[model samples]
Target: MQYSISQDQNGTHLDWQHKNVSPEMIDWFWSNMEKGFLLWHPEEHEPLQWVIPPKHGNLIGAVHIAPQTWSDGKRQNLYIRFEDFNSVPDAIKQYIEYDHCIIVAGLGFGEGSLHVKEPLGYRIHQWQSDVQNSNSVGVIGKSNAFGWKKSENHEQGMIWAKHAGTEISNWGLFLPQLFDLYKVVKNTKYNPFMDLSVKRIDGVLQYKTAN
Candidate 1:
């Protein structure tokens, strides 16, 4: 396992990686894991594997793990904030009525979505876009970051509506893995532990191929 635990005033955050992980290891992490988690897709596997822990307490925010498939046929895996997944800001929760996975708000603690916290707010450096593109992909929430545009092009992760009292981007941009997840499954509400903890969450996301 690989990990990095850091410290700040509000609390201490830990990030780590584990190799040869099974289902139990993943259970331990989500249960004992810190509040901050973000993984990247390994960038090698065509499609990887990932596991989503059951709803932990109140999910503050979360993103599907990424860098997901770069191991020896095992798979690459990364992290997304837990808040994004658990907060799931919709009533019907139809981020994709067809798919079943919904993108919720994240640490979007400041300007981007909602959440008034300072440190977690959307970082100006992390937020960028090109007004140049007048074309987008969807209708409801097209432009990423802050839905800055009213057109269509490649608004990769703009899927769900935001929960009130929060300002985090609940959109799941094409993180390579999620892009593939969107293509394959029935949804992303994964609670079944098929003994996979060190795999990419994107590949793990369960989607049903349209018959």
Candidate 2:
């Protein structure tokens, strides 16, 4: 998809033309793209700030999130922390104090085109409780086996995918290289796991329905 941006008296504007694209989809695309551009060029955009120290030891990654206004005049923000779920530090939890947050994690895959089925877990209990405290909010997981409560309030919700394709691909491609780089930089042992726990659920659904 191609997109164009223009600025006028009425703030900045974005225009895009693509077949079979809905207005809502276009708005979502534009919003994410704008946020991504701001993230990629942090020097140019000062909206996103690093609230915690980045991991520089065996793992080389950083955490960054940006707050922006939604079209409905409501404030919303996304949090991104590029580190192992198990290795997240406590200091960074303060940055994710938003009323609504979505925690997306990729469940690793195992053999036979099945989800790895690891125990579904969250790093911060306070946030989980906060989400629960808000009666009008709840969490949703791709796999219902996860311990997320269902609620009537659909307006505010959190979703987790059993196997997020983009995240699996990203970790699959980046982790090996990162491990190798870490070994060389820190003079440590390198253990690479080529198993990417991901499968396309759409195809599975179609096959099941057809069969």
Candidate 3:
């Protein structure tokens, strides 16, 4: 599969040609693209601050997201933000924002489809353990994040996950692993997230999602 990225006044756009790309994948890509656009212009929303605990003398950086308030009064937002931990000269003292970050997780495309990972659900399970050990905030709420696996071959794609509040401790520890996973999966020739365990499949290009 071949893909290209371009930017215009409208925002960044992705164009690709692939044989096995599925309808579900196209929908996933477009939805994520819209979310990306919103992040750049999140002036109207409230920024939620995330704080992770210190580990081995190194403190993970904080994360912020502008959550959209629903008509029913639910505040929710789904997006991706990546920060480089190694670049921080002093992780113990810095609180970095999303302004300098990139979408390193939560979005992927290959094998003729798009993939979104729901590590937050897995995070919730970890949080449960933390709560058992008295290391968490102990507040349980509906995960602002919810989705299903896109491909049949992989047990993991995007799944459902519960979201704890912004002040959850030790949550930042998951960043490095998640980022590494993103780097590996996105660059692989075959989409491991897809069924058939193949990256490029023989099929037809019915149409293009974006020109």
Q: Which candidate is the best by lDDT?
A: 2
Residue pairs clashing, model 2: 109-197
| Candidate 2 backbone overlaps, count | 1
**Alpha-carbon TM-score of each model against the true structure:** 0.21, 0.24, 0.20
Q: In candidate 3, what are the lDDT values of residues 5-110, reduced to their tens digit?
A: 3333212223222233222332222222222323322433454432221122111221223355533345545433322333212311122211111122222223
* Per-residue accuracy of model 1 over 22-81 as CA lDDT, tens digit each: 223232233222221232221342332223344433222433333322223434233334
Which digits, one per residue and each the tens of the lDDT, describe model 2 over residues 1-211?
2333333321222222222222222112111222233433332233654333232221112334445443334453434333342343233223233222222222222222123233222222111112323343222111111222222122221211211212222322333333334344432122211111112253221001100
In candidate 1, which residue ranges exceed 4 Å CA deviation? 1-22, 31-87, 91-104, 109-114, 117-155, 158-211
**TM-score, cand. 2:** 0.24
Looking at model 3, residue 18 earns an lDDT score of 28
Q: Which of 2 and 3 is ahead in TM-score? A: 2
- What overall lDDT, based on C-alpha atoms, would model 1 receive against the true structure? 0.26
- lDDT of the candidates, in the order given: 0.26, 0.26, 0.25
Task: Name the regions of candidate 2 deviating beyond 4 angstroms.
Answer: 1-36, 39-46, 53-61, 77-80, 87-153, 157-211
